[model samples]
Target: MSDCDDRALIEAAQKDPLAFGALYERYVDRIYNYIFHRVGNVYDAEDLTSRTFFRALSHLADYQDQGYPFSAWLYRIAHNLVANWHRDRSRRPVIALDEIVARSLSEQHPEVVTEARATMRLLREIIRTLDPVRQELLVLKFAEGLSNAEIGKILGRSEGAIKSLYHRTLLQLREEMEKRERGER
Candidate 1:
């Protein structure tokens, strides 16, 4: 959606529930995927996505345009909520095993599926160790498929900074994987 359309929806968001509904429909899937990638759990991601929208609607009066896109504001809200979740949690890694898919895939190609799942788990564990900014960057860039400029706006950074961070993050992940492969971790 264009900035013009977002502005209209945002203005009506405070007064018209239907307008807010439109905004929710536009962003819910992206927001949910973002949360899902960060939290790595379907249920928590669902709950957090619900909370993010609920909080947005609850605080509609507080949102000002400030020349930023409506999505930037939503992303800030989501980022803050996810940060708070990380802070408040007791710190356990919870993995969502898609059992139905895994089961069927295993039946078809047991070894390949098992190796892929193991690699996925390893990668997730490595990602979970990174700082929150890098983690959010990855989620926003890949999961949301946001452009660097867009991510910069949501992250309050310059596009160059986002690019630099992205480069470093990739290198860090690659190094970690290499170490693991060499049995050095």
Candidate 2:
């Protein structure tokens, strides 16, 4: 949608709370998918998505058009919530590998799930080590499953620049993971 289109929608929504439904409908799925990828769980993703929209709806009148897409505003909200979620999650005590294996021994089919979860957790750790821009690009591209053009638009970068950054980010992540595997931090 064009900036004009979003401006109209925003104005309408500002006038009537019911009109906000249109904006919500337009962006909910994308927001949900973005949150899901960040949190890696349906329950928290759904909750955080709801919170993101709730904050957006309440602050509708305060929103100013800074020449950015409406979706960008929603994404900022989602990103903040996700960051908070990660911060909160980090404070919880972590289970040791032995404890996890002991617990998994009781499950009938834990092998695949355990392995997949381990891989994703390791990948998340590696991603967290990246610079903020690269992390955002990875999440927008892989987590939200957006195209390079879409990511470029959201990030305010040229498509060619996004492609170059993505390539470099992937190379760095591969090198980091390999080093990690070789008992190097």
Candidate 3:
């Protein structure tokens, strides 16, 4: 895990407010990106990301180290919040990395703008077509770099089960990609 063990940070934060800032600094971008990718918009993503952290902060005292790691717990919270948002809004949202990359490209470097835009568009379409669970798995595994065991912890399954599911999900994604390519051809 990252050296910013949330458990330790939370513990310290209970005593010192400054410690919580460190935690926020460490996780804010990730939480934002995660939500943005899932919801496909800036407003909802920002709201959900803030709510996730707020809930975490409010429930910090209830947190315990189950040896599963802290990110899992935070992700679980974020996932539940997003699910609730979906339920309440009665909408299935899709977050496109293309939007994010485009914003960055516009702000910083214009040279690679074309390449980044194309890649992000393809990536966003592929991600949008994935089953919701597969999309979450990819976010956790590839984007967050969490292990299968950690994914299981976040997802409430066993490590073996998570590994099996990930394999199956990858196969499904490959088949879908191939089918899309064939159709394009």
Candidate 4:
């Protein structure tokens, strides 16, 4: 864990409101990225991102260290908020695969980017098809580049259990990608 612990900051914030801004500044980017990946829209991402911090600030008194970093606790709040958003909407987000493909192609070459974009688009689509828990697990493991142990803290699972789930989730994603390819061919 880094020396700059957010739990301590949160505790301090509970005593003084101004201290909370430090925590917000520290995590705004990460939280925004996390929310953006889940929601796939900058506008909704911004709103949810703000809401995450707002909710966290309100519940700051309830936060406990529990060995995990303060960022993990904040992530839990963001994760729950995303889940609730999905449930309330009752509609899966429509990821803009074309935009991703176009941006990749423009940055590289159509020939070079085409296959990669297709794979990424398929991957994103397949991820959405999985259960919410699986989806969150994959996003945190892959997109956020979190270690299994770190993920365990965020999701409140054993590190070993997280490793197992990570492996299984990767296998499932690979199978889904392969199936998509086979169908295309």
**Highest-TM-score candidate:** 1
Best-to-worst order by lDDT is: 1, 4, 2, 3
Scored by lDDT, the top model is 1
What TM-score would every model get versus the actual structure? Answer: 0.90, 0.70, 0.77, 0.88
Tens digits of per-residue lDDT for model 1, 115-168: 877777777778878888998899899889999999999999999999999999
Tens-place lDDT per residue, model 3, 1-185, is 35356667778987776677777887888777777767878999989999999898888778777776677777888999888887898766766566557777896667689877865666567767777787887888887777888788888889899899899887876776677657762
Which tens-of-lDDT digit does each residue in 28-84 have in candidate 2?
A: 998987777566567887899999999999999999988667888898888888778
Error of 2 at 178 (Å): 3.8
Please say which candidate is ahead in TM-score: 1 or 3.
Answer: 1
Off by over 4 Å in 2: 91-125, 128-132, 145-163, 180-185
Query: What residue runs in model 1 are displaced by over 4 Å at the alpha carbon?
Result: 92-108
> Which residue pairs of candidate 2 clash?
none
The TM-score of candidate 3 is 0.77
Q: How does each model score on lDDT?
A: 0.85, 0.80, 0.78, 0.82
**Cα deviation of 13, candidate 4, in Å:** 0.9
Tens digit of per-residue lDDT, candidate 4, span 4-84:
576567778999888999989988988887888788888889999999999988988777767778889889889988988
- The Cα error of candidate 4 at residue 141, in Å, is 2.0
Q: Alpha-carbon error at 86 in model 2, in Å?
A: 1.7
Candidate 1's error at 141, in angstroms? 0.9
Better structure of 2 and 4 per TM-score: 4
Model 3 stretches astray by more than 4 angstroms: 1-5, 99-123
Candidate numbers, best TM-score first, in rank order:
1, 4, 3, 2
